[model samples]
Structures are given as C-alpha cells and as structure tokens.
Target chain A: MIRRRFPWLSYLVVVTGAVLTVVPFLDMVMTSFKGAGEAGTLPYHFLPKAFDLSNYRAAIDQLDLPVLFRNSVVATAVITGSVLFTSSLAGYALAKLRFPGRNLIFRLVLSTMMFPPFLFFIPHFLILVHWPLAGGNDLFGRGGAGLTVSIAALAMPFLVNGFGIFLMRQFMVSIPDEVLEAARIDGAGEFAVWWRIVVPQTRPVLLTLGLLTFVQAWNEYIWALLISTANPDVMTLPVGIQFLQDYVDPTRTMPIVMAGLVLSILPVLILFLLLQKYYIRGVMLSGLK
Target chain B: MVNALTPTTTERAAPSTRSSSPAVDGRARSRRRQAVVAYLFLAPTLLFFAVFLILPLGFALLLSMSRWAGFDLGGIQPVGTDNFAGLFADGSTFLAPILTNTLLFALGTVVLALAGSVVVATCIDNLRFQGLWRTLYFLPIVTTVVAVGNVWKYMYEPGGLVNGVLNALGLGSMAFLQDPDTALPSVVVVQAWASVGSAVLILTAGLKSIPESYYEAAALDGAGPLTVFWKITLPLLRPSLLLVCITQFISGLQSFALITVMTKGGPGDATNVAALEMYRQAFSYGRWGPASAAAFVLFVVVLVVTLAQLWIFRRKEEDA
Candidate 1:
C-alpha cells in the first residue's frame, strides 16, 4: 500500500533528477548547433536560432579532427587489444596453471592495484623520454627525445592494466579443471587448450574488459596532453579538444569546441550504448570506478 | 554439497596413493612443463611490470630525494629531504591552500554526492523506468572530462543555463569560477553531479537488499516514510554508504583532470589542489624535485586515508 500510494512524488523526483542529468548533454548538442553570439551570451537560448552545420566544419578544419580521430582510434585499439590479450593470458596462468611462486605472483598482481595512478605520471614520462635507442637516444638513454616523439608513448604505460588481469583471473578461476585437463590429455598443448576452451568461455569477460579499457583510453587526457606537447601528431580527441579551449578564444570558438566535443564523444557514446551491458557489468565488478 | 566435497576428496586421495616411480617422474615432468608454459604466458606482463612499475617506483623515489633538470640523468643531485622541506617552508602554498583545498574539495564532493545519491536512490526505489533514469544519470560518466568541464564552464557563465535559471528563479547571477570563494564549490558541485550516478547505483543495490517486510511492518505500525527510512534503510545501507564515501573521497583527492580542463587551478590558486599543484610544479615550472616530493606527500595522504577506512570498516564488520 505504501509503495502503491503517492508514487507521484517518486515520479516527480526521478524525472526532475533525470532531466537535470541529461540537460547538460542536450545543452552541449544544442550549443553545437548555435551560431556566433547565440551561445554564451547575456540571455541564454536553449534552442539555436538556426541549426548550423558550420561549427562542425569549422571544428574539423581548425582542430584537425581526422588526425585526432585516427590517433584516438589507434590508441584505444592498442590499449583495448593489449589489455584483453595480456589479461586473458596472465589470468589463465594464474587460474589454472600449477607453478612455484604462483601465489606470490597473484598477490603481486593484486597489490599493483593499491598504487594510485598519479604516482606514475612523472616517472613514466621520464622513463619513456629516456627509453634507449627508440627516439635517437643512446644506449644509456641520453642525447635524444627518446620514445616521446613517437605515437607509442600515448599507449605505453597503459598497455597492461592490473585491474584487468585481476578481473579476468577472478572470472577464470571458476572454469572447472576437468575442462582443461580433458583437452590436455587428448594431446592438446597448453596454448591449444587455452585458445580452444578457455578463450571461448571467457569471451563475455573479454568484451567487458575491452569496453572498459576502450572507454578509459579514449577519454584519457592528461597523459595524452603531456605526450602530444612533445609531438602534436599523436594528439587524441580529448587532447585536441582541450588544446582548442586552451589557445583559441572561447567566446568566438565555444560553439566549434562544443561541436568538436560532440563529434569526439560520439564514438564512445555509441560504443557504450551498444555494449552497455558488458560495460556496466565491468563497472559493477570493479566497484572502484 | 557434491561440488564442495569433490575438491576435498581429491585433495585427500592425492597424497594417500603411492603411484609408480615412473608415474611420479612423469608428473614431475608435466609439472615442470606447466611451470614453463605459465612463465611463458606471463612473460610479457611481467616484463612490462619490471620496466614500467618496479623501475618507475625506484626512479620516482630517487627523483624525490634528488634534484634533476629532467635532461641529464647523471646530473641528478642528491639533496636528501630538502625538496620535502621546501614544500613546508614558510610562504609555501603547499601546506596552506593547496593541500587545504584538496581536502575540502574531496570532503565536499563526498558529502554532496553521498547525500544526493541517497535521496535519489531511495526515491528511485519506488519508481518505474529506473534503468532509464540511471542511464540518463550515467551520461556524464561516459563522456570525457574535457566535454564535462567545458559544458559546465560555459553553463557557469552569466548567459549560460545555470545563470539563466537563476535569473528565472529571481536569484542573481553569480561568478561561479571567477570568484575565488565560489570556484572550489562550483567545481565540487560538478564533481558531485558527475559521480552521484555511481553512488546511486551502489546505494540502489543496498536499498534493494533491505527486506520489504520491514517497510510493511513500519506501515502497519503507522511510521512515516522518513522515520522508516531512518530506522531501517539508513542502518542497513551503512556498508554501501561507507564504501561509496571512501572510494569517492579517494578519487576526489586524486582527481585534477577536470580541474585542468575547467580552471587549471586558476584565480591565483584559489581552486588549486595538491595533485594539480604537483602537476604544475613538474610540467609547467619544471620543478621535478619538489613535484616528486609533492607526489609522495599526496600519496601518503591518500594511503593514510585508505588505510584508516579499511581499519574502520574492518572494525565495523567485526561489530556487526
């Protein structure tokens, strides 16, 4: 009776909150369509005077959207692919393989999650800058820009995520030993067994991990900013968009920036919506963010 | 029960059987083969950790205790605790506003997010189309901080949606980011708004676990919604609440990317936090030594808060 009565209050609150949450995104879209002086003016207009496509053109021309999109896709693909491959490989070893120091290695993998990522920004950059023989550096990691001048710098530090490995291992632990043992006794190598049995069974988790990594790598800004500051050719979408806001006058270019944001976020938005089930499961499993 | 019993039975039978010596040798060989295969599988990940993780920690530690111009490794001057000392020296903002702002920013976000999530989660419990509402709330989480910060920054302008609403509601337009007083809180509001969805997700899970019978009994007893909530929901929801609180606090403390996107710790360090200060010190000013020291200081703060939460949660679990 309590649940049935006065549900109007619940509807009002939920709908209001949902609107508030969705309005900014709607504003971003509408503002993207807004013309010069239509946005960020003394009197706000929710709808644009005319639905303009010029901002989209201007955003592409000014921000080099194609290059940025290419960089973003490459980085995201590399990260997602590497994370999935490494996580599954290492997860299989930890879950099923018998070895000395197995427990110690698993503990180490778990402990890696304890270190906050901010701690690594300085050292990771330095290590990349000093990476020997990559970007004209000497064997002793000196006399050159090292790897920072290359696109790999954007994807290097994030290649192996501890949490991905941990998530994969936890899920993989449930696979019955008999499944692998049966394959093993039938003359299949460990690699064959893993590829044939374990990999197929773990597809759902792999998709979840891949989506999570893809979204994160796509949205990563600060590190991309740092790397692209060294070489602009590797600038991802977020970095490129931020670069516009940093240098270009916002009053004149706010709409273009908004347009760029709309375009930039579209890929992730579409991917997330399409695969939200897997991604949401990933979040529920992570519980940390 | 059978599944549970099989593992123990197999374990007990393994050592009791004395198989042939050749079989034992074959088992040993297979075990060695498995170990080799395992290491082969883990090679890439382990190598990455050795270079990226182990090496970086040692390097950061060395850099913190020493001074480097970020060019020549051989030129690093070991200065002991001087970098850490300089951060706390008189006239340093590291101790006063930056660290202070960091704490306040984190605490404010946690409080606002926790409150908003509790209300929304509770209300949402009685609603239809809950998934739709949650997905709507989750839009900002998926969007890049670049988009989130810029949209919010524009909205903070006098001609933006927020101020327009203020005017419509008979309130004066306020300088959200320009004024030092409101800058931090404005950013806090955005952060809370962005994070409230996840908190709600957690709290909703918590809410669903509280038995409906409690509410039924409360209704029969003529208790009000607020009272039933306080007496039943809040108490049962403490675990999830604390989980949300501690995690949000930790992330809030570490977060500066949105700040970088929005204000860049501007208005004369009014919104500056420790992590952003550390970033500026290293990247902008090229003060690698002090920056590394700042990183360590912030790391210790985060570690202490995390450990304290764990301790408190453990104690609470024991009590429960």
Candidate 2:
C-alpha cells in the first residue's frame, strides 16, 4: 500500500536513472558510426548522419584488432582457467581434506584478500621482469625483458585469486561429508573424490566464479597496460585501443577508437548478458565489484 | 555477501571430518595420505601466494627503502627513510595535491554513490521488473574502465554530449576535464556513476531483508512515504548501508583506473591521486624507491581508513 501510493513517482525516478545509465553507451554506439569530423565538432549531435561502419574497419586495421583479440582471449582464458582450477583444488583441500597446517593455510588465503591490489603492482611487475630464467633473464633474474614480453604477463598476477579460493572453499563446505566419505569408503582417492563429487556439485559456484574471473581478466587494464607498454606484441584490446587513442588525432580518429572499444567490450557484454544470473550472484557474494 | 564479508562461521564450525579420527591402522595410513593429498591440492595456490603475494610484499617493502632505477637488483642503493620523508618533504606535491586528491576523490565517490544508490535502491524495492532495472544500472560495472572512462571523457569534452546538452538548454559550454577546478569532481562523478550499480544491489538486498509488516504498521500510523523511509527503512537498512559504505569506500580509495583513462592526473596534477602517482612514479618516471614509498603510504592510508571506518560504524551501532 505504501509502495502503491508513489507508483508513478517511482517509475519516473527509475526510468530517469535508467536513461542516465544507458545514454553514455548509446552515445558511444552512435559515435562509432559518425564519419570523421562529423563527431568532436560544433553542436555535438547525438546521432550520426549515417550509420557508416568504416570506423570499425579502420579500428581493425590500424589497431591490429585480431592480435589484440587473441591476446585478450588467451589471457582471459588462462586467468579464468587457472583461477577455477586452483580455486577448486585449494578449496577442496581447505574444505574437506584432513591436513596439518590447514588452518594456517586457510587463514593465509583469507589474509591475501586483505592486501589491496595496488600494493602488489610495483613488486609484481618487478618480480616478473626479474623472474628467474624466462624472457632471457638468468637464474639470478638479470638481463632480458623478462616475462613482460610474453602473453603470460597479462594473466600472471591474476592466476590465483584469493577471493576465488575463498568463494570455492565456502561453497564446498556445504557439500555433505557423507557423499565424500562414501566416496572415500568406496576406495576413491581424495583427488578423485574432488573431481567426481565436489566439483560437479559445486558447478553453480564454479560458473559464478568463472564468469567473475573471466570478466575481470578480460577487462583488466592497468597490468595489461603496463605489460603491453613494455612489449607491444602482447597488447590486449584495452591497451591497444588506448594506445591508438594516445597516438591518434582525436578529432579524426575518435570514431575509430569508439569502434575499437565497442568491439573490445562486445564479448564481455554478451557473456555477462547471457550468464548474468551467475555473474550477479558472484557480485552479490563478493560484495564489491 | 554480508555473511561473506564477515569471517565465515563455517570455517571454524563446519565440514571438518577430523572428529571421527582413531588410531586404527587404515585410518592412520589414510590420514597421512590425506595430508599429503591435501598439500598436493594446495601446492599450486601456496606456491603462487609465496611467490606473488608474500614475496612481492617483502620486495615492495625493500623497494620503498632503496633507490633504484628500473633495472638491475644490485643497483638498489640503501637509503633508509629518505623515500618516506621525500613524500612529505618541503615542496612535495605528494602531500598536498596527490594524497589530498585521492582522499577527496574517494570521499566524493562514496558520498555521491551512496546517496544515489540509496534513493534508487529504496525506489526500486517498490517497483516491478526489479531485475531488469538492476541489470540496466549494472552495465557500467561489467564494462571495462577504458570504455567507461573514455566515453565520459569525450562527453565532458567541449564538443561532447554533456556540453552539447548545456548549449541546447541556453547555457554556456564548458571544458570539464580541462578546467583544474572541475577536473577532479568530473572524474569523481564518473567513478560514482560506474560504481553505483553494485551499491544498489547491496542496498536492495538490504531492503529485501526488512519485514513487510513494519512498512504495513508505518502505513497504519499515518506515516508519510518520506517518514517511512527515514524512520523505518533507514534504520532497518543501516547494516546494508554500512556494508555498501565500507566496501565502496575501500574500493574508492584505491580506484585509479578510471582516473588513468580519463584525466591521467593532468592539467597540472589537478586530478592526480596517490595510486596513480605511485603508478606513474614506478612506470612512467622510473622512481621505484619513492614509488614504493607512495604505495606503502597509500596502503597504510587504506588500512587506517578501513579501520577508522569500522570503528566509526561500530560506534554508530552502539549509539543506536
């Protein structure tokens, strides 16, 4: 009844907010089609004169969209795959397996989340550059460009997410011990029980974690930017697009950058739309994005 | 999420199979093997934490104390307290503009997003198609900061939509990011806009947890909508509100991605924040020692703010 009293007002507020939320994206899409000089000029039209698709073509050609796409895909896949596998494995151990120092390790995993990510940026970059032996670095981690030139740099710092492990562990705790014990009694090893029982049952959390990790990895900018700057060959979409933005003439190439961005975010947008339930659940579980 | 934010009760209370342990030979052998297997499962994660988490932290501390160029570990010259002192030294922008902007940026974001999300969340609690509305709000959250930052940057440009709208309304067009006075706040608005969706999600969940009878009772007592929100909803939603507040505040303090994409802390360092400064110091300027110092300072700020936030929240609950 209280809600019923202000129905129109509520709709007005929500719709207004929705328009505010969606307008920037609509502008981005429209601007992607705007012919050169038509955008970033006097009057700042909301719609393009014609929905020309040349910007997308230019974005692909100049920005090397395919290389960027492959790098993003590889990095996202590696990060997501690593996060899932390691999270599930560690989560199983923490949740079900009997062990010494289990409490310490679990607490360590929890404490990892306490450290803000920015603190690690400098050291992570340094260590990777000096990472013993890879990228022509010696055992003492001296000499070449290090792993920063490789695709692995895009995914390394993110491979083992503390939150992912914590999430998986929390969910795995819910799986009845009876199922696990029965499996063990049936002579199943701990690894087999984890693979056969815990993982299959925890599919929902996995999907949630996977989607979260995938989007995060795909959208990761600062690390990718750092690494990409070192070796442009490994540049991800965000970095490549930004590089183009940084180097190009904004008035002439704004549409191209917009087109690149639209293409860059498309995979993630579609994935999030399709699996949004799991993604939202992950955010709900994790609290902050 | 509220539960997850808290130390998990299940960690201590649930899923431990150790209660059935006995001295039987099979059990003893299995226990040994189980420990081995558990360690095996945990090895990769432990190794990663050791290398990435623990080692990096230790290395960061070292770098904060030593002066070194980008390359060569041996090039590090030990200079104790110099880096830390330099940040606060005379004529250092680190103290005045950078750290101050960081705090202001973070504070502004928390306030704006909190206000917006609360209003929208409360309204959405009464609406149909709540999921659809939430999904719309959450688009920015799923989008990369590049897209969010660049779009807003262009919009704030002289020839962009924001100024376009202003000119259409018979008002003057202004340079948003270029003006020193308006630059920080301009980026802050984008940060708040991008982050509001998740805060709404948390607050909506908070709103759902309130029993319907309370609102029903308020209605019977002739309380108006505003009074209902102020008296009943606000008090009931405090936990979730506080949850949103703390989480957003922590994130806001460290979030420089949007700033990087939009302003690059430019126009005479008007929009520079601590994290971005730290990033530029290390990567852009090759000042690793002072960069790490800035990072340590920033990390301590985050810690202090988080603790202070918790204390303030605790005091509020007590006062209530």
Candidate 3:
C-alpha cells in the first residue's frame, strides 16, 4: 500500500506523455509508406493509404546506402576501437601506476571535459585542412586539401575521449593492488597484467564505455557534416541523408528521407534495446547525453 | 629537449647498476620499469592531446583574433579584438537575437523537459514494468537528431499531425515553423521532446534513492499526496534536478544539430543561436575570424552560465 498505489491520475498522465512521445515515430513510419502526394497534404492522415515498398528502394538508391553505410561502419568501428584502446591505456596508467605528473595528467583529462566541443569545430577543421602531408598537400600544408579529404578525418578528433578515460580510471581504481602484485611476483609483466587481469576484470564497464562511445560516434553529426562537405567520399549516413533532404525535392522525397532515417537509426535502436542496462548505467555515471 | 632525455637514460641505467644492496636495488629497478611502462601506456593519449587538443586551441585562439577569409593558413592577418568588437558593433545581430534566442531556447527546453520528466518519473516510480516504460521513453534519445528533427519538422507542416489535430478540433491550422514568432517555440518543443528521456532517466534514479520510510511517515501523518510530493520528493530531488538543468542548459546553448536539421535557423534568423551563427560565419560566409570569435563568445557564455548555476544551487543548499 505504501508503494503500490493504483493512482489512476498517474496512469493517465504517464500514458498521455508516452503517447505523445511515441506518436511522432508512428507518424514517421506511416508517412514513409504514404504514396506520392499523400504526405504533407491537407487534413493529415495518421495512417497511409498504401504500404509502399518503393520509397525504401528510392531511398537506398538515391542516398547510395551501401557506401554511406560502409563509411559509417568504418568510422564507428575506428572511433570505438581507438577510444577503448587509448582510454584503457591511459586509465590504467592513471589508476594503478605511480608515475610523475600523474595527478596533473588526471586533472588535464578532467579539464578537457569542461571545454565544449563547439569550440574545437572551426580550429579542428582548419587543422585537418592543414595537416602537413596528406591529400596532395606539401610539407608546409599548402597547395592541397590536406587530411580533410581523407576517411580518417571523421574519426581523428574523437580518437581519444577524456570522459572515457575518466570513467575507466574511476572503475579501475577499486581493483585490488594485491592481485596485481601477485601477478607481478608470478613473473607477469606490466603489459601482460594490464591485458590479462585489468581488462578481464573490467569487462562490464568496458562494455558500458564501448556502447556509449559507439552510439555517440555513430550519431556524430556536425563534424561528419563538415568533413563530408569538404569531400563527398567520406559521407556518413546522417550527412548523406541530410544531403538528400536538402538537395532533392522535398515534396516528392520526404517519404524517401523518412525511409532513410528509419534505416539509419535501426542499428543503434537494436543495440539500445539489447543492452539498455549498460547504456543506462553509462549515462548515470557520466551524466552526459 | 635532447638534453632532457639524458637524465632519463642515466636514471634508467642507474637502477640496474646500483647492486650494492640486491633487495633494495631489485625493488628500485621494478619501480623504474613500472614508470617506463606507465609512460608507454600514456604515450598515445598524450600525443593525441598535444596535436588534437592543445594545437587546436592555440590555432583557434589565433584565428579568433585574426582576419583570414580564405583557406590559406599563412594569409592570416592579426586584428586583435576587432572580431570580438564586430560581434557587438551596433549593427550586429549577435547580442540581440542570436544570443537572446540561445538563452530562450535553452531556458524553454529546460523548463519543458524538467516539468515533463519530473511528473513522468514520479509516476513511473509507482508503476510496474518501469523498465518497459523507460525503454519506450528512451526511443528518441537513441535515434539520431536527423530523424528526430525531420519527423517533427514534417509534423509541423500546415497539414501535419499537430495542425491536423487542431483542424480536427475545429480550429484553424497554424503555420508552425514558417512564422517568426512560432518558429523558435516549435523548435524548442522538439528539443524538449528529444531531451526529456534522459532527464527522466536521471530523475528516476534520483527518486529510487529516496527512502521509502519517509513516504510511510507522511502517510501516518495523514498528509496528502501532493503535500508529500512537495515537501519530501521535491527537496530531495534538488541535486538531480540541478544536474539535469545544468547539462541541459549547456547542451541547449550549443546544440545546433537539431536546429540545423529542422529549421536551419529559418524565417529570418528567428531561431538562430550563437553556435549556428558561428557555424554559418565560418563555413557559409568564410568569415573565419568572426566565426571563431563567436565560438569563443559562446563558450564564455556557457562557462558563465554553468558557474552561475553551480553558485546558485550551492547557495540554496547552504541556506536550506
């Protein structure tokens, strides 16, 4: 009775909010199936008159889904892999090893989080544009487009995440030093101990960090948008979809855009559903969206 | 720099040669080895920060203060404080509408999301299948901003779902995103909608930490439900509430992705925020100096607002 009150008012409010939250997605799906001239019309219909499969094909063809999908997959994989590798390494050093300037380095990691990402967009773009010896640029980074034309541009700035390092170090701190000492006495090297003991011990946390990094890296828009604008070869899914949305005739292509959006979000949606516990715990720990 | 490596090499060699006391020497050698290994582990991350973080910052600082219109890095001509001055130089739109719109957008999102999440979180706490309900709420968050923005943008059309509902209720259809007055609010609602799920997640955790015995005591005292909520739940939920507000404010201040996707700061800059303006200045018009200046200005605003929020919350906590 204390906790399980059947407050019908609460039910009404929650259900109403839930319906409001969900109806847009339903509208998107329904609108995706609407035939030409059916969408964005007078007296909006909640359901489509016909279940059209042509929109999906049009989206796939017009957006070049395969290339965009490949780019996105590669970018996400590179970012997630690099962040995991760097964060784990830096985190192990910060948490367990006693090196000179350890506290200073840890504080630097924390300070990096406070500087917002928007501050870096302009300069990061410029740096990529002037990155010494890539994409026909000379050693002075002149006469060429530099790294902006490369596929690595999408994943470069985000390869080392300060928050990921912080999260990893916080988790790794509770690992007993005695176990590490035991391994050391047993002739295990530092690299072996970190790889075999520290990593396996922090599997769940690593998963949480990895999933957080994955979703973030996958859905990254502004940087990807900038890079894709510089060179179309590295366009990720969101950038490609937005490009279609902008350049194509919206009246005819709205359904196609919706189709593309649905396709783009499917991977993250499935992952979120499957591993929400880890994702939620990640959010709780980081307090970041 | 070359000389600095001399001591490291000598120190490393000393660990092996100081074998007068074998046991102490062994421990010292291991410690030295561990330090080397730690430095090895930290090398890549430190290198990344040096190139990506520190260099970009110095470059941004230079660009913000200089006038470099084109792609030529060497063509930069330093014009100290002029870019910052131009942002507020009488004819500027930076101070009045863009920054003002940023504040309003952020404030509107925080209010709408906080109210919505607080209600839903408290209600969900009393309900079964909380995980299911939470998963449903979290759908928008996992989805990309392009999807969220476009779906809602389509729904905000004259014949869209919102206007359709209005028309069904015998009201006239409003041009939601087209008009200057309604454009910012329309985008604000979408921003609030997209962010409410995370706020709910945080608030639910906050609610779970509240002791159940407090509720029982309130029940024994014959206090009503609303009273219990006002007195007990609201006060205890302050920290989570502050966190949600600050994070939302910070994100809301700079998040032009949704704005870019939905309205693109349309209807004559009705929905233009500082970040978007900065983006357009750099990318669209090639005004690198003013764009980087705008970026710095917006960063300062974010920093000031966040610190002010912390101060206000801390003071309130002290008073309480």
Q: On residues A1-289, what C-alpha lDDT tens digit does candidate 3 reach at each position? A: 4555656877887889899999999998988898899988896899999898899998899999999999999999999999999999999999999867899999999889888999999999988888888888899988888999999999999999999999999999999987876676566788999999999999999999999999998899999999999999899999999899899888788999999998999999999999999998998898878
Query: Which ranges in model 2 have alpha carbons more than 4 Å from their true place?
Result: B1-23, B309-320
Which regions of candidate 3 deviate over 4 angstroms? Answer: B1-19, B309-320
Proportion of native contacts kept per candidate: 0.68, 0.75, 0.67
TM-score of chain B for predicted candidate 1 = 0.92
Which 10-residue window of candidate 3 chain A scores lowest in summed lDDT? A1-10
For model 3, the local distance difference test gives: 0.90
Error of 3 at B174 (Å): 0.9
Better candidate by lDDT, 1 or 2:
2
What's the residue-level lDDT of A15 in candidate 3? Answer: 88
Q: What is each predicted model's overall lDDT from 0 to 1?
A: 0.89, 0.90, 0.90
> iRMS of every model, one decimal?
3.6, 5.5, 4.9
For each candidate in turn, the TM-score is 0.96, 0.95, 0.96
What digit string (tens of lDDT, one per residue) describes model 1 on residues B11-130?
A: 423442455544444455567778999999999899999999999999999999998885888899999999999999999999989999999999999999999888889889998888
State the TM-score for model 3. 0.96
